[model samples]
Target: MRVRLSPAALLTIFGNCVKIKSVNSIFDFFSWLAMAILLITAIPQIVLNYKRGSTEGASWLTFGMLFFGMTVLAIRSWFVTTDIIILLNYNLGAVIVLIANMQFVYYRIKK
Candidate 1:
């Protein structure tokens, strides 16, 4: 016996093989991993700032630029995915950079 398949039928078959939710979940997992890694990268700078009791040699301009960039990325991520990981990654990243900027100001004034 011979069988003929329509485009809709092929789509249905392929669709069953690959699910949108599963693909999104995979991306979400990676997003969470990336978020964790990126967040960790900021910690060393924060700790160094705290331990040293100042942010000398660190340019406030750098952190200021980072804050603005992160804030914009966070907003864009919210609109793009609204996924918790994406939201936290960008928003928390922005907050961290903002704190770094504050550290610069606080320490500069302290000196």
Candidate 2:
């Protein structure tokens, strides 16, 4: 016996596929924009730390926690295919935290 698929069934499947793609596209765009914002916000702090050669009032505990947290977040994002935004933000944040922490530690030791 041969089986036939109805037009409504075919249309429903296609419609669902389009919806999923649309949602994914929207998520990707928003995630990309969020990552850009994170980068922009972090760059100034990173630059200031480099230029000043100090972490001054910034707490070591704070930066250390942030560095570790971001590192873990980045790794988690890597495991989830849909988390590119998180991956970018956390990885870049980790780098910035590491740089700042290093500067802080160096100045503290120097003094």
Candidate 3:
């Protein structure tokens, strides 16, 4: 038995599928891009602290609050699902913040 399909129907299905995939691809790209940018954003602070040999504007309260929040968020992401990108980025950010926090403590004591 042979069945005939209309060209318009096929075109419509193909077009919708392509549209959905494109949107998904765009979203995935931006999500991971933001993750990468956030992961690296902490480096400058560390560098500045190194160059200055002290932590000036970087407040302990700010660092503590940010790290705590990030840690909580990462934990939540872990419990909810295994999103490696989210887990890695948030944890890395927390670690970087910890490094900065330690530099502050050390430099303050030295000064």
Candidate 4:
């Protein structure tokens, strides 16, 4: 006796073999790693400025570049995936960089 496979049955079998949630979880971890990196990258500058009572050593140029890159990441995120992982990752980083940028500008003008 020979068994015939229908398209739907084949698809069901293939889908069962491919765990989409696992793939998504991997991407989630990747996004979290990126968020952690973004979180730390500006902390040293923020702390140094706070300790020194000035933003003298920090560069607006660096923040500007970071802002530009994060902006692109945020925009690209709008059209991708479930619109949460990458969006949150990039937008939060953008906000952090924006705050750092404004602080730098304010201190630059103050000093």
Candidate 5:
């Protein structure tokens, strides 16, 4: 006996095999990892400022600019994914950075 496969069926089978292998998707994992690094870098600065009770050498203007830019990026990232992990990570990072900047401004002004 002989078997015949339609073009559409063959394509679907190939796609399924690719998916099963987990090697055919175009999603870039590194971009999110980079965003995570950006977030992590903010932590020590925040901790230091908190511990010292001052933002003496820190530039509020720099943080303000970054906060604004990241806010825009976070908004743009929203429509790009249904993945809760990505959305939450970027948004939370933005919020934390914004709050840290505000604290810096407050401490600078208070001193």
Candidate 6:
């Protein structure tokens, strides 16, 4: 059976619609879209690493830089505003980077 995804479902999962005050509705939608895309940018590489049971194709340096960058952005977002979408973007990016980093460690140790 094929499952259908509604726009509401996508917004519910990726967009903090309720929490975000509407400044311009179009801009707000695009902002959430951009944020969601940025947040998941690392997922493909992470999944690839996991499936391969190795991080050979991934770079520790890149993940380290991403973790550092995301941490800084999350910290800045925490201090600057309480916008849920912004907060989620940076914070979730950090978590994703950390998970990738952990995979690096795990696979390295296993070798």
Q: lDDT values of the candidates?
A: 0.81, 0.74, 0.78, 0.81, 0.78, 0.82
Model 5 per-residue lDDT tens digits across residues 1-111? 899999999999999998866642334466567567867877778888889998877778878887887788689879887878767766886897898888887886888
**Higher-ranked by TM-score: 1 or 6:** 6
RMSD each, Å: 5.4, 4.0, 5.5, 4.9, 5.5, 14.6
For candidate 3, write residues 1-111 as lDDT tens digits.
998779999999899999999997897687568556655666787898899888887778877787787778677777875868667766776777778778878998999
In candidate 5, position 26 carries an lDDT of 33
Q: What tens-digit string does per-residue lDDT give for candidate 2 at 27-49?
A: 76875685576567556766776
lDDT score at residue 77, model 5, on the 0-100 scale:
77
Q: What is the lDDT of residue 78 in candidate 6?
A: 100
Q: What is the lDDT of candidate 1?
A: 0.81
Task: Name the regions of candidate 2 deviating beyond 4 angstroms.
Answer: 1-3, 57-73, 82-111
Candidate 2's error at 14, in angstroms? 1.3
Model 5, global lDDT: 0.78
Error of 6 at 50 (Å): 0.8
Write candidate 1's Cα lDDT for 1-111 as tens digits.
999999999999889768977897897788678667757866788889999999876777777887888889888987888568568778988888888888888888899
lDDT of candidate 4 over 1-111, digit per residue (tens) = 999999999999889767787798897898788778878878777778878878876777888999898888777787775667567788888888887887887777888
Q: Write the per-residue lDDT of candidate 6 for residues 2-106, one digit (tens) a residue.
A: 999999898886666554545456665775685577556778888899899999978899889988987898899899889897788778878989999999999
Instruction: Give the RMSD in angstroms, all C-alphas superposed, for model 3.
Output: 5.5
Model 3 CA lDDT for position 36: 69
Residue pairs in clash, model 4: none
The collision pairs in model 5 are none
